[model samples]
Target: MGEPKIRRLDGRFDDPEIETAFMRDSWAGIRVQAALTLIGFSLAWIVSTATDLMYMQDSPYFLPTLSARLLAGSVGLLGGAWVLMARPGSDSRDLPLIVYGWILMSTLTAVIVASVFPTAEATPDGVADVLVFTSSWMSLHVLAIGVALAAFPWGIAFMSIAYMITYLILAVVWNEQSEHPMIAQSVVVVACCFFAWLMAITFSMRARRRFYITRLYEQAKIAAEKAQEFSSFLLAATGHDIRQPIYALDLNASMLEELVDAEQWDKVKPLVQRQKLVASNVASMLSSVLELSYLDNAKRPVTPTTCDAGRLLRDSVSGLKDVALSRGMALHCEPCSARIQVDSGVAGHILSNLISNAITHSKGSRLLVGARRAGQFIDLVVADNGAGMGDRDLFLESRSALARINGGQPLRSGMGMEIMFRLAERGDLALRITSRPGHGVMACLRCPRV
Candidate 1:
């Protein structure tokens, strides 16, 4: 078996489910972060403005449009808050575009409005005007792009390109009116724009790297803990379950030895048969354990072919009929005409566990196994008129967590359902359980119909 492929947040995953989940989560966080940062900064700006502590409040360029920028910022803040609940994770693509547009519109309008506003009793220093404009505009550019770094690197890349162009245009406009060292100052501004882009790229990737490593670490820790737990439970479980047949075998062996010593040959054949039954039961138990090991490591390769659904059902129940009858229960299967595409052994094993579980633990006279076609799929169900699981929701929550044997009252490994879960996961089969406490549990395995 190959190693499990790790899911990466920055790149594609081989598994469709993993890829979808990673993208959904990544975008969700990005949208929420972007929205909150915009709203939070707007709130901070309002508080500072009310206290008359704005850094560039006295600057000439900002003095002309401070009220206008504040109004725009407040409006944008309301829009951000509106989107906090209206947008879902799937709508993340449009979120960046909308946010970038809002920032661009507000900042550009403020700059354009301020650039035209004439200063009465004008000072003869043009470079001083450029310096004031640069001071205010550079801060706006930095703040706008700075809030976007939490979004994925892809969105940040697009934003950085657009913002760099916007900054360059602002630099060119201001350069026309500035006197000395204008070229050098423009170059520095562009360099700073580039630096902001590079910083966004660096920090975004770092955040993703941290999240990916953390995901792998958490998954590894959980898997290790579960493995340890299952191991400890299996050791004690095998001892208790295997002891019955082993004790029966010991008794039969002693009986056979006494019969042989007494020359009572008549009873030898019956005793041998009983010994075979006990041995066979032990062999079956061992086989189940081995199969679980294979499934755990995903070592078993599934090769599906066309097979009769009815024959599959019968084959699954055939081995368990004797055991079920011995427990005063009847095993019945309704024939299915639908043909299915599945590994017959795998499907049969899943059905066998479900039916055998019904037989061993359910308080009922009859166990019903059947299959039927439903559009492109066929559902194979095992149901009995017996006491069902106390917590049906928990049974469906996690098979590993519900490690109680046979879906019964005792605290034992829910080994059958756990095995069914592994097989269903490997086969891409849909398994569902429905039960009422006094009604019964219906375990359904849905396979693709051929």
Candidate 2:
């Protein structure tokens, strides 16, 4: 009815499933990146240590440079261990891990630059070389963050700003001895920050889009499978249910032919009636199946009207009276003056289906239809004192009855109950069915009272 809410690529979503999935997927990649970072830092530390010992051991910045590299490598090792050991399914921890790695990487870069820069011999050419070296070193960390850890745009912005602030603070502390100009260093920091932010947004948006496409594809595949199953169930159920009635009709036709040849006029009337009854049953079954199918697939709107509950109950029973009588069952209705607000047609169909099902399957001598008044509602009940169904049978009936229409397992004789259930749902009525072994089955449809 309205525009769907847009999901911002902030690593949090309104839907918990999407949020959990995004975090889980990102964590997988994050773990691999963490391992790679650990290796890279370790290799860098080893190479830098060897270079310092062989060539730059006499330099004033040598100890600080070596110390900074060791610190960075240690941080990388700790981060990698933590990320790898933590469960990827722990969605709440992934963001913290990314932020933690970014902080360590950024702070270490600032420490190394600040400690070594102030002690360097200042020269025009030397300043340019130093800036180039620092920028190149910083860019690696920036790229690692951008490519490895999938972060929210705001998180990237925060890490970038925090790094710049830390660098500026360190630069201010040693401003006098610093060889590089503040503006040049600031420019480099800003550029790296902007790049990281841009990458974060771009990667997040792409991930969300991919997730949506994958989700839709999965849903479509499931629906296709369900449709195929439903088709197979339909064919099997229709064949099994329709065959009995058609066979009865054929047997009646043969008997009628025999009776006519003998000129048995008295039995002819009842035999023809029996044939019509069998044909009627076939038609009813087909109609119920078609209606149930339509109800399952289509959105049918219900228009409620005030109706006399007693009259509605009586009418439903009266229509099915002949069918019940044919099976030697007595159908009775108790009087109730309660008026209910409901979709009368749907309600009537639901009642008739319930009555028919009881008459056909209950194998009982008596069926009762009645209305009872409750506070603000009236319960239209159709109960049968038949051989009764056990708890398992009732459970199966309730489960497979309507679920079968929607591609679930089919019950051989559940169409009538399925029709009743579907109509009750469409009409927004609460239908409850309860049964006990040797105590028969009772169905109650609760409707709003006028």
Q: For candidate 1, lDDT tens digit of each residue in 361-383?
A: 77778899998778999999899
Q: Model 2, 56-133: lDDT tens per residue?
A: 477877877777666666666666666577635544666365546645564564556544653464555564555556
Per-candidate Cα lDDT values, in order, are 0.62, 0.65
Clashing pairs in 1: 403-414, 404-412, 405-412
Off by over 4 Å in 1: 1-71, 81-98, 110-124, 128-140, 147-177, 236-244, 247-274, 277-281, 298-450
Best by lDDT: 2
* Cα deviation of 367, candidate 2, in Å: 1.1
Q: Point out the worst 10-residue segment of candidate 2 by lDDT.
A: 1-10
Provide the clash count, candidate 2.
0
> What TM-score, over all chains together, does every model reach?
0.62, 0.65
